[model samples]
Target: MRPRSLDEFAGQEHVVGEGSVLRRALDAGEVPSLILWGPPGSGKTTLAQLLSAQVGAAFEPVSATSAGVADLRRAVERARVRSRSSDTRTVLFIDEIHRFNKTQQDAVLPQVENGVVTLIGATTENPSFEVNSALLSRSRVVRLEALGDMQISALLDRALADTDRGLGSRAVELEDAARRRLIELSGGDARVALNALELAVMATSDTNGSARVGPEDIEGALQQPALLYDRAGDQHYWLISAFIKSVRDSDPDAAVYWLARMLEAGEDPMFVARRMVILAAEDVGIADPQALAVAVAAQQAAHFVGMPEGYLPLTEAALYLAVAPKSNSALRAYAAARADVAATLNQPVPLHLRNAVTSMERAMQFGAGYRYAHDQEGGLIEQQHLPDGLTGRRYYEPTDHGAEAAIADRLRAMRGVSPRVSYRDTPRPMIGSKRPRGQAFGDRTLHFEPHVPLIGGRRPNTSRSCGAGSPIPR
Candidate 1:
C-alpha cells in the first residue's frame, strides 16, 4: 500500500518534522534540486515517491548504475516535454547518485539549475566526494538516519497487524521476543524488517487455526546460508566496527582477536589489513616509524600469502601497529606542506636550485649559486634553495619522540645552516649516493674546548674518533 502522506513516513522526525527543511519543502508544494544521503533502505526512494504524490508532480526515476550523460539528457528532454503537455513539473529521482562520474554529474547540472526537472538524487556514499561541486552547490543535502530500536519495533508491530499491507490474515502471531529479534535483525532498515517478516510469516504453519511465529520460527525463516553480513541483522556492522576500534585502541591482543572474527567470517583480509595499515600511520606515526613499514610489509605479505595463512603476517603487523607509540605529527606536516603548495601552485623555483644538467642550462642562471657541502669545515654552509617566496619554509615539524628525536636534532642544526650553503661550503656533496661504510661527515668531536676544566687530572680529550671519518665536530 502506498503511504498517503509524509505523516505516514516513519522515523527521521528530525528531518521530516514540522519546520524541518524536508517537511517545509514538501508543505510548500515544491521540491528543489536536492540530494537525500543516508544508508540503505532509509526511505530515500520512498521519500521521492512521496514527494511526487504530495506535491502533485510527475516523477521520473533512473539508476546511476545504468544511466549515463545521454540517459540523463533524455530524461531531462522527456521531463521538458511532459511539463509542456501536462502543465506539470517533473521530479527526476536518481538512486545511487554518487555512482555518477564527473561528466555524468555535469550533464545533469544545467537542467537542475534551470529548473527543467527538480532533481532528487539519492546516495549511500558521502555526496561531498561523489557529487561535483557545481551540482552540490545547487542542491540541498538532506541526511536520513537509520531507524532506532523503538522505531524498528514500531515498524515490526505495524507489519504484524496491518491487515491491508501486512500478512495479518495469514494466521500468524509474532511473539514479543521474536518481534524484538526481528527488530534487532533489521538493523533499523525497514525493507529488511519487512522482508524478514515476510519470510517468518510464510514459514509459520497454522497453530490451532492461527499460526504462532516464535523466535525459533523466525530464525528458521532466515536465509539458510546466512548473509556474510546481516545488512539488516545484528552481526553486519558491529564486528567491522569492533575490529577497527580494536586496532585503534592499541590492544594488540584485542586487535588480533577481533581480526579473527572477521577473517573467520570470510571477510576480506586485504580490506581488513588495508585499514590496519591506515591505523598504523594515522594512529601510529613517527613515534615508531617502523610501525608503518611493518604495516606495509604486512599488506604485501598478506597480499602474496592470501588469507588463512596470510592472516598470520596481518596479525603480527596489527600487533605492532597497535603497540607502536602513536603520533600523527608527520601526517600533519605533510598535510600542512600540501596545503602550502596548493596555495602557491605553479610557483617558480629559485634559479640557484634549478637543475643545470645540460651545459647550456648551466650557462643560463641554473646552478649559478649551488654549492658543494663536502668542501666545508663540517660539511656546513648557509644558502637559499627553495622558491624565492618559500625559502626555508618549515613544512615537516618533527615530534620529539621515538627515533624522531634524532631527526629533530639534525633538523635543528640543519635549520640554522641552509642546506644549499652546506652543499656549497662543505668539503663533500649531499652524496650522490650513500657514503661508503665508515666514511662519515663532520668533525668527530669527542674532544671538548675545555668548556669546563677537569676538576681532577683527567684526560682532556676522553672521547676519541672511532674511525677516520666521524660526524662529531672538533
Candidate 2:
C-alpha cells in the first residue's frame, strides 16, 4: 500500500522525519523543486505525491521513459493554465527523470524557473551525471537509503493487517520463515516485498478462511531472482573486488559466477569488462601475452555488440584470464624502475648514450663510440645505456613462469652476461655474524648500500651488485 501521508511513510526518517529539512519545508507549505535519489522502491514516487499534497499543488505525474519534449510542453501548459484559472500551482513528478535526454530535460527549465510547477524529479542514478546541470542546480537532491529489514518487515506487517488497502480481505497469514525469506529476497526493496506478498496470498487457496503462505509460495512469486546488490553502494565495490580477485586466483568457476551475479544485478557489463582488462595486464601479464588482447577484445565487443550477445565475449574473456598462466613480474618490474627513478631523480645521461645531434654536442662526445649493435656479430654487443652512477642496475626480473621463462633466456643472452650469484642458494646469516665483505671484481662492479632497501628488496639474501662474479652478500 502506498503511503498517503508522510506520517505513514516507512523509513527515510533522515529526510521526512520530525524537524527534517523536507519536513520543515512541508510545514512552510512552500516546498522548492527537489530531486529524490534512491534505489527502486525507496518511496520516491510516494514521497513526490505526499509532497505535492503537502504543498496543496496539483499533482502531474509523467514517466520520463515514455514522456517526450512534447509531453513536458503539454504539462507545462496545463500547469500555466491551472495557475491562472485556480491560482493553484502544479507539482510535476517525473519518474526515472534520468531517462530524459538533455534536450528533453531542458524543456522543463522555463516552467520550473517560473514556478508554474515545482519539479519533483525522481532518479535511481546519480543526478549529477544524469539530470541537466541547470535543473539540478535549482533542485535540492535528497538521498533516500534502501529500506532496512526492520522497516520492510514493519511495512509487511502493516500491509497484512490493514484491511483497507492491503491483503487483509484475503485473511492471509505468512509463516515466520516465509516472512524472513520475503524480506531477504526483497533486498530492502518495499515494492518487491509487497508485490511478492500479494502474489503469494492470491496464488494460494484460503484454507477454510485464512490462507497460510510458506517460503515456497513466496519464492514462486519472485520469478526474477536477485542478490542483495546496490549498484550505487558499497556492495557494488565489494562484488567487483571479489570478481577481480577470483580471476587473479585463477578460479574460472568463481570468476564466471561473480561475473554472472554482477550482470544479473544490472551492473554495466562494460564496466566489468574493463576491470577484466586491467586484471589481464596486472595479474596475467606476459605469462600469457594473449590475456590482455582477449580482455581488450571482449571490452570492445561488449560495446559493439551490446547486451545478451555481449555477455558471451565478456564471459569468455573472464574464463580465458582465469585459466591463463598468472604473473605479476611485469607489474613488479615497472614498480622497481619507478622506485629507482624517484630515488635517483635527475641523474645525468652517460656521455656515450646522449645523442650527438649538433657540432658542439659531438665535440662534447655525447654519442661518441656508441656501438652499432646490429653491425656486431649476432646483432648483440656489450653496452651500458643507464646513466652514470647507476650502471648495471637491474629492474625487470623475468619469472620462470610460462612465456616469461623463454623471455628470461633471451634477456640473459642479450645482456651478454648474467649475475652468477644464487640468492636462494645462499645460506642464512648466523647470529652475530659479520656483514660479508664486497668481493673484488673488474671496473664493471656495481656497488650498492647493503641496507639501501631496494624495491621488494632483491630476493631474500641476494647481493645488490649486478656485475659478473658478484657474491651473494650475507
Indicate which candidate wins on TM-score.
Answer: 2
Error of 1 at 373 (Å): 17
Question: Tens digit of lDDT per residue, candidate 2, span 86-175?
Answer: 999799999999889999898998888877889999988878888989999999999999999999999999999888998777678799
Q: Supply candidate 2's per-residue lDDT for 48.
A: 92
Q: Looking at candidate 1, what is the lDDT of residue 189?
A: 80
301: Cα error in model 1, Å: 4.2
> Cα deviation in Å at residue 363, candidate 2?
14
**lDDT, candidates in the order shown:** 0.72, 0.81
Off by over 4 Å in 2: 207-209, 226-242, 245-257, 263-274, 283-368, 371-447, 450-474
Could you tell me the lDDT of residue 184 within candidate 2? 93
Give per-residue CA lDDT, model 1, range 174-280, as digits (tens): 89888887777676787887787787776676565467778776667665423335332334457767876777777778888877877776777777778877877
RMSD of 2: 10.5
